[model samples]
Target chain A: MAVAEIKIELKKGVADPEGQNTKKALELLGFEGLRSVRSMKCFQVDIGLEGDEALKACQDMCRRLLANPVIQSYSVELK
Target chain B: MAVAEIKIELKKGVADPEGQNTKKALELLGFEGLRSVRSMKCFQVDIGLEGDEALKACQDMCRRLLANPVIQSYSVELK
Candidate 1:
């Protein structure tokens, strides 16, 4: 078995309200020196199969549903 | 300046409906060999301040808002 870790984040130039809000909140909470904050989603998948087949399936999944290629970028790590 | 990456995930034994649904979605989409799926949130904060002060502030944020200590676990990475 293998585990595929997928990280999805907004592409550069895209505005992230959640990240902005968090930064504001941090400042309000007295946390200083914050330049910016960005947020992303991560998925950890456990695959019953290993090797190339699993990797391909995961890549397909990412392309089809896990990420929006137009607005987000993703990276996959298999272990 | 520094960048702080925070990863938050559900604690062991906690139920994750989103993950389960995603796993089901992958199977329905014909991606085989999926045993399970788990999801988490990742935050990337850019800090103008470096060293221990920034780290301490981040830790406090995690404890107070970024994560629910009772149900989730979080890790911080500084770069």
Candidate 2:
């Protein structure tokens, strides 16, 4: 069995409103002295196969869906 | 300076509509035999400080916003 670990790395300037809102909430809750926050998404899927073939399939997912290639980069670990 | 790495892991049955839609697109585009797909989000931030202090701040961010603790688990690595 092939396990695909998909990790998406978003650009620093992508305007993460969710992250920004979180920061404000944190400040209000007395988490003072905290400077910044960012968020990323990860996916682990079972490819039910092996090797480069599985890699290609997952990469396709990254390109077409898992991430916006224009704004993010993806790394895949096949285990 | 403190570097905070934010990772969000969503539940397996969280109804990833985006993922499902991606799967369909992949099949239509000729990539066959793909059974399932899942996705996650990650973030890396410079906390402008150091040590356990930063970890606590980031964890606060997770509890308040980075993740919906009811449906997700967050892990933080302070570097």
Candidate 3:
């Protein structure tokens, strides 16, 4: 079996209101000294294959479907 | 300061198409023996204050803006 973990976030140049709100909320909650915050999405997939085949499929999915190369980047970890 | 960790997922009764696709993609990637896969969003925030003030703000943010209480749940930690 193959497991791929994908994380997606806004491009660095983009402004994220969600992330900003989260940071503000954290401060209000009593978490001081916080310097930065960001928002991200994560996906864990279990492929039914093994080795190279699974890795290839994950990359293809990332390119073709899971993410838009123009706005998002993903890293795949296979186990 | 207060740091709220919020995890949002589609309600159990809701079907998650994105998650399903990710599972399929993973199988194609070669990760075998995987039993379950899910998609989630994560946020990390550093609040700029300290103590009780921070905690309260975080909760308020979660309730007022960060998440829809009807669809999401969150946990908070303070340091």
Return the top candidate by lDDT.
Answer: 1
Q: Which TM-score does chain B of candidate 3 obtain? A: 0.67
- Candidate 1, clashing residue pairs? none
In terms of lDDT, the poorest run of 10 residues in model 2 chain B is B31-40
Report the C-alpha lDDT of model 3 over B1-79, residue by residue, as the tens digit.
Answer: 4444444555565667878776676567654455666787766556675667766666665677566667666545564
lDDT string, candidate 1, A1-79, tens digits: 8898889999999999999998888888878778899999999999886878778777888899999999999988889
Per-residue lDDT of candidate 1, residues B1-79 (tens digit): 8788889999999999999999999889887767789999999988786889778878898998789999999988899
For candidate 1, give the lDDT of residue B15.
100
Worst 10 residues of 1 chain A by lDDT: A49-58
Q: What is the lDDT of residue A69 in candidate 3?
A: 78
Please give, for residues A1-36, the per-residue lDDT of candidate 3 as tens digits: 677666677777878887787677767765556677
Q: Each candidate: how many clashes?
A: 0, 9, 30
TM-score of 2: 0.71
Every model's TM-score:
0.91, 0.71, 0.59
Candidate 2: which stretches are off by over 4 Å? A12-14, B12-14, B48-53
**Judged by lDDT against the true structure, how good is candidate 2?**
0.76
Select the stronger candidate by DockQ from 1 and 3.
Answer: 1
Q: What is the TM-score of chain A alone in each candidate?
A: 0.89, 0.74, 0.85
